[model samples]
Target: MARDNKAMISGFRCLCAFIFVISACSIASFLYSCQCTSPCHDPGREWGQSLTPNQTIDLLSFPEAWNNLNFPQVPPPWRMKIAVFVKKWPHRSQAGGLERHALTLHLELAKRGHEIHIFTTSPINASSFPKYPFPNLHFHLSKPTAAGYLDQSTVWDQFQAQNSSGSPRRPFDVVHTESVGLMHTRSRKLTNLAVSWHGIAYETIHSDIIQELLRSPEEPQAYSLTERAVKVVEEVKFFRSYAHHVATSDHVGDVLKRVYMIPEERVHVILNGVDEEIFRSDFKAGKNFRRNFGIPKSKTLVLGIAGRLVKDKGHPLMFEALKQMIRENAKFRETAIVLVAGDGPWGSRYRGLGSNNVLVLGPLEQAQLARFYNAIDIFINPTLRAQGLDHTLLEAMLCGKPVLATRLASITGSVIVNGNVGYTFPPTLELLKRALYRVWSDGRGVLEKKGEVARQRGLQFFSATKMAAAYERLFLCISSMSGGDTENQCQFEDSSR
Candidate 1:
């Protein structure tokens, strides 16, 4: 009996030591991820956070070496180059949604051994883009055209001088343009051309501007008028040359097809995705984040919002809902709190209101923002309207938060109305109030269940791996278009309702 007891004690000691080693390594890995300042880690993390993969696997983990972070069995590094043309880049002060997406796509391509050149107009706001973390990425300031635009020939000539001294100039493996109104060149001259439409084109703006101009008497505005007209013509001509078109959302895809008569086969949809390896909730972080925000532990209730604090994002709607909730029941005032993440034109205005319940955390990097997801019982995306799928909502979902999204065109009611994940509402205060009440009544149970469902859905349909694979296939198919005149101006009747 004495010998058996000694053996059991020794076994326990060994098990404890193994657990200690795992705990120590896990903590160290988390600290490393938290300290990472790569543009990839730019804007989100809740304080002192760490990441753990689904099975604690290091495959595609955060804080990874660039070359090691990619899909399993990814194509061997190929000698390919693609240029991403955009009007602005992040940190250039012109930082907006477009710039963020540009960085994201560039980073993804660079990981795949594709040389990426980020070309942009002379930023209106001096873009102090963070020093790129990846060794393979490059940026160039294209010589401006006569009108100071990044027209096709402007970039083509910029590359012309650098051409290899050999027979048949090596055509670019791909020319990818986004947001910028890409100037189309002739099909035979170019091998691979792609345009990523963020939303309705500058031509959409042109039609509206032209109508407004014609309404008023031409006040010697002929020079500016004629110049804009010429630019529009060039843009249309340029678009016809795009062999492959990409859109971030179905709404934008529909707009492109209707506005430019693009075909369904030619346009590809690549939804923006969150980096889950960074955004996963510290399932253990419950209550800690709430305490840091000074909320009492008794109430399992807090409202959360993230994104630009602009009117279009529906900040006022949230304000109205709060007022209604306060008036409806004095009890809710004690239980509810709202934490707004992100800063923009209206952030100051909301701060000025000085509501006791609203905590405005201006803007946070990606991983830091995950804590806000950790802190709150519910997430609200009251965008009155949106041009594309609000990726903020997707991130919230990834973090296991139940979303309260508006029934907007981009986030169709059908897509978000799954009872287990979130609730959809028309842009009305009453509807918002009702939704909040339902969420608050049994908030914890409802949110937990919905969060599980969200994780499953995201894994199955919305992962970066899935999105990248889709694009890979799309790229392969587009590169094979050797015949058929893709520029035939047949009027496109959009069937993508």
Candidate 2:
């Protein structure tokens, strides 16, 4: 029995040795090769991981590259304190009309010396060191979102926390709101908060293309039927509700009243102004510019288009109209040159059509755009897609160019002079072509007459400085006013089905 016990003990010792060797080997392998929670194939880093391979990686914490719009111009000083809430401050979609208008408002307000704080997304393309220093103007980067739609919960929590934290901040005097999502939609009391409305949000949300465009992503967007139903509910429940709104035009104001049922008292009509200084240049056809851009300086009847490549800003109608103009109008054969400028999804398709007369010269940076503005004697904005007025039309008029915009842009109130400062037409190509021919007539005499009328009309009403002054009064009144009629505001939103 003693000998048997000794044998069992020896066997136990061998088993122990084997276990020790296995544990040590495991430790050595772990030290050499890291175990990653994430797999190698994940494209957007949905999960974090570690690897044995020594690699450098760069990531975008914010998805949108929005720093292209610079709010650098320092405003001198003005009395009213104003806070404007936009999705992104230095956003690049300046061609999107609203973004450009927002920048123009910011600069004009800052120049006037009004205390302005712009709450926006993280700016992407600013100086590495930091500049655009001004006491009057301030820009705050809102919290970024990892998830969209449902991500608003996190955004709200962060905003509420920040507001409560009170870091390097004073109470906001007035808040001018725009767009969907974030502050614009958040129905907080935010005392003395003034909402800025371009028009009824419902008008835009119901468009067929916009509905389809939202789902046209490469990845599965989780955009099922239930999600869309929830979105519609949320829009109705939250977005349509506002304390007050400043509509940029009377037509839009009427829509707010008739369509959205917003009260007249709650809706204020404030026209957007064009900056004559920036749009109107000596524009003396810089040397070789007319030739380099493929045009004759003297006799060539140049028609310029400068806006987004979106189907909404009326590009399709304009293209079709140009086609009609060239095909039918004999006079266009000698003098007509269609210069379409700007960039978008439809850009390649526009270029691919390869109409010899229609030169899709890609997009022009603002400076380059100014030269093109000078190059053309006539301007066309066939914006059938969106409802708001075209700032480009204002720019064109300031450049002493005749414009042919749709009747929808009747909001500008500057498109016609006894039906003369250019002309108005429906989105139909027939109307657009007929109007274009009437204004330019493939002749210098008619172009000069129409151009002069356009410039005069622009000077009469579209000056940016004047608009800034209007906003100053608005800011002061809104900030100083207490006990706003919230009941009326709610009643209007509810009734405007």
Candidate 3:
């Protein structure tokens, strides 16, 4: 009986291995097909070669001398009636990265005299529906699902009604969706629609792998490779329903064209941007913030991290690295301080390192976040997720603080362009430890200089104004194309002197 049971167990193991091999081969073949059939196969051309001059400006320098102009300051040649679809808006305490992005982008667009209409889920607190801050910005609220996501059917109904009203002789000049509006986009052909992909299933698969690899052996795995493969296939098909795609990072844009088979012309790469007005450097505010937190002026380095303190956000990497640093080096334990701003399961774990080493401040408001960024000498984002670029990293840089982040393509390719701006390490405890030690060895003055470099890069590429301007150009180009203008005429004119 024992011999028979052993044989059965061995047979089961063999069967599972066979299934995994088959699944992996299937995914590999699909990716190979993408590469063969897409522009990626062309040896003479580059990943973004097919993009027009305007679309490549963010990734490559402009041919002409460019001036850093604020989007709101530039008067639009013509006002555009725009419809935006997003899952949620910033209301009360429900501010996530996507919500903040939608708010920032639309606010800037509205300020520039664009008619902005937002279709989003109702606030959890029904009475918390605030009045519109801008006359051109209107909101069409839909009841949310139990999962707190927007009701797609309800949003579609509202959108259709607005289109049917015909108050404006023409329909919306351009429709923008922030990783939402799938129901509406899939239902019909909307020539002027642009869907911004914050993260795709292919990227999520990479994230899941990183999370699983980093997770402790005792922790139950949260992802199945087989399931992820299936989901990626489904996502590639579903994405084809949209007319245009906005990739939040260059790496993502590359993936959209090379792996997802999105046409290079249809994919636009725009890095995530932060509100420079709020997050810019302020030495006085930094000093005040440190004093309020009771951090001593003598502390050699004040390292900080903000955003959800969840495992996927790479808290485990920071927690483990810092804990080891304190345990191994008495000088580090005494001289360095880590400020953790945000709430999650890892909050208690971070606090477990003790108040002397790590200050676990709960989730902070935007104003407080600015102060937090200013207070820190160096910002550390040990995130494992390789999807969208974290706004916190950009915010920190805008506040003139350097970053030590994971070496993800999205971040390394865009945000941390060079060692002068910041440092990066592979997602491993040993590499992270080495990177942290380097930061400690370099000290404050060196890091501050790096921070200045990072701030300059942030202003040029990742500022909210820069982001809005890119979107503005894209919207106008899309509108022009829909009106039967030639693609060459849609080229964005650089108004910089």
Best by lDDT: 3
- lDDT for model 2: 0.56
What lDDT score goes with residue 321 in model 2? Answer: 68
Candidate 2 per-residue lDDT, tens place, 1-497, comes to: 99999999986775565455445534743552354234221223311233223332111111111111111133324355566666644343343555566777877877777666666555444443134557777766645455322234554554454443334555555667655434544646565665655434433432323334433366354423333333434544554467666666544554455445555556555556677776774457533457786565543677778777776666666666666666776667456777778888766666654555667877776567766777787787776544555677777777787777766523333235344467677556667777787766546577767778878766655667656655555455455455352322111111111
Q: Higher TM-score: candidate 2 or 3?
A: 3
What shift in Å separates residue 12 of candidate 1 from its native position after superposition?
A: 87
TM-score of each candidate? Answer: 0.68, 0.68, 0.86
Clashing pairs in 2: 75-110, 75-111, 77-113, 78-113, 78-114, 260-496, 261-496, 312-385, 314-382
Q: Which candidate number maximizes TM-score?
A: 3
Which runs in model 1 stand beyond 4 Å of their true positions?
A: 1-73, 76-79, 92-94, 121-127, 142-156, 159-170, 184-191, 201-241, 254-260, 285-287, 352-355, 413-417, 482-497
Clashes of each: 15, 9, 0
Q: Compute the lDDT of residue 222 as modeled in candidate 1.
A: 32
The candidate 2 region of ten consecutive residues with least summed lDDT is 59-68
Which sections of candidate 2 miss by over 4 Å? 1-78, 91-95, 123-133, 146-169, 181-185, 199-202, 205-240, 281-288, 297-299, 328-330, 352-356, 409-418, 440-442, 483-497
Q: What lDDT tens digits, residue by residue, belong to model 1 across residues 1-497?
A: 99999999986776565456445535754674477463222212221123323223221111211111223337433435555677656663234566666666667667677666666665444454467677767776654566756756666665544334223545445667775535554332555667766554332333333334433264443333334434444555556667767767644554455445666556655666556676676766646777777777656677789888876667767776776676678678777778888888767655654456677887877667878887787788887654556777776777777788876645652135366777777666778788888888876877888877776655544455545544544444444343242532121111211
